[model samples]
Target: MQPVVHLAVGYLCYAAYTRLHHGREPADLPALVAVFAAGLADLIDKPLDAAGVVPVGRTIGHSLLFVIPLVLLVWIVASRRDRRLLGVAFAIGYLSHVATDIPWHVFSGDFDELGFLLWPVTEMPAYTGVKPLGTVAGIEITTLWLEAVILVAAVACWWMDGRPGVGLFRPSHRA
Candidate 1:
């Protein structure tokens, strides 16, 4: 999925999860943080390769082994403060990104290519078939549908939130 779509989907997921579990929406700043953080793995991979470092793309960030521990560590350290909300928000976004990639991998007939989900336990060449790299124009119907869903969710969430402007950066003032 595209970076913007990942962010949109992450926002929708965090909003829905918080609303359902806590009977309240996540704060705007944390919600936005979650959206960006959701795509952090994909964003980090490219630079790692260019720097002559181990190709971490699709390997380290996408790994459940890595994500789970990272999220857990944040959750644990933030257990005493409101920062826990931020941790949960980040986790929601990160995990949702991982979940959304499954169908893309499967549709691309590269289900086995998702060794990154396993991380250190498995080693395989990270496939780039589903991503638009170079002249490849890697496009798929599943990805299109997912993007549409993200758009719709973003619009719906905006409407539900009263279409706030700067208010989106703050927690809801409502009880």
Candidate 2:
């Protein structure tokens, strides 16, 4: 999935989680963390792959090997800080990113593309020449439409949530 799609889906997931768990709009800090975490995989992988530090774009960052321990650590630390929701938000974002990448290959029965999930245990598949910011494999038109729908839904949901995290970027007015 594209970065924007990942971000929108992450926010949508977090927003729904907050509504279910807290019965309110997402809190600012957790929402922000979720958004950042949504892009964290690509942020880590793409740079290393582009720099030739890793053989493939999805290796460690896309692996359950990495994310499981990382999420657990985050959960432990956040629990100690009494901010477990932050950890949950991060997990939702990160896991959602990995999840979003799976369905295309699954539907097409191209399981090898998912070898990245196991990392060194399974060889990283050869690069498919699909640009990260460009078209997805196999179903470009459907993916584009899906991304558009997700973006629209995310914006509508955020608006309904009273645009919760937007305040984090603006200076607060204190009298």
Compute each candidate's TM-score over C-alphas.
0.76, 0.89
Q: Candidate 1 residues 1-175, lDDT tens each?
A: 6767777778888888878988976666677668777888777765775675645567677788888888787778766675887788888888888887777766667767778788678874756654422233565354566587777878788568765234755676776
The digit string of per-residue lDDT tens for model 2 on 14-133 reads: 998988888889988888888889889999999999999989898888999998999899989999999988989999989988888887666556678889898978988875533223
| Highest-scoring model, TM-score | 2
Which pairs in model 2 have colliding backbones?
none
lDDT of 2 at 158: 81
Clash statistics: count for each candidate: 0, 0
lDDT score, candidate 1: 0.73
Model 1 TM-score is 0.76
Worst 10 residues of 2 by lDDT: 127-136
Q: What's the true lDDT of residue 82 in model 1?
A: 58
Q: Which stretches of candidate 1 lie over 4 Å from their true place?
A: 131-142, 162-175
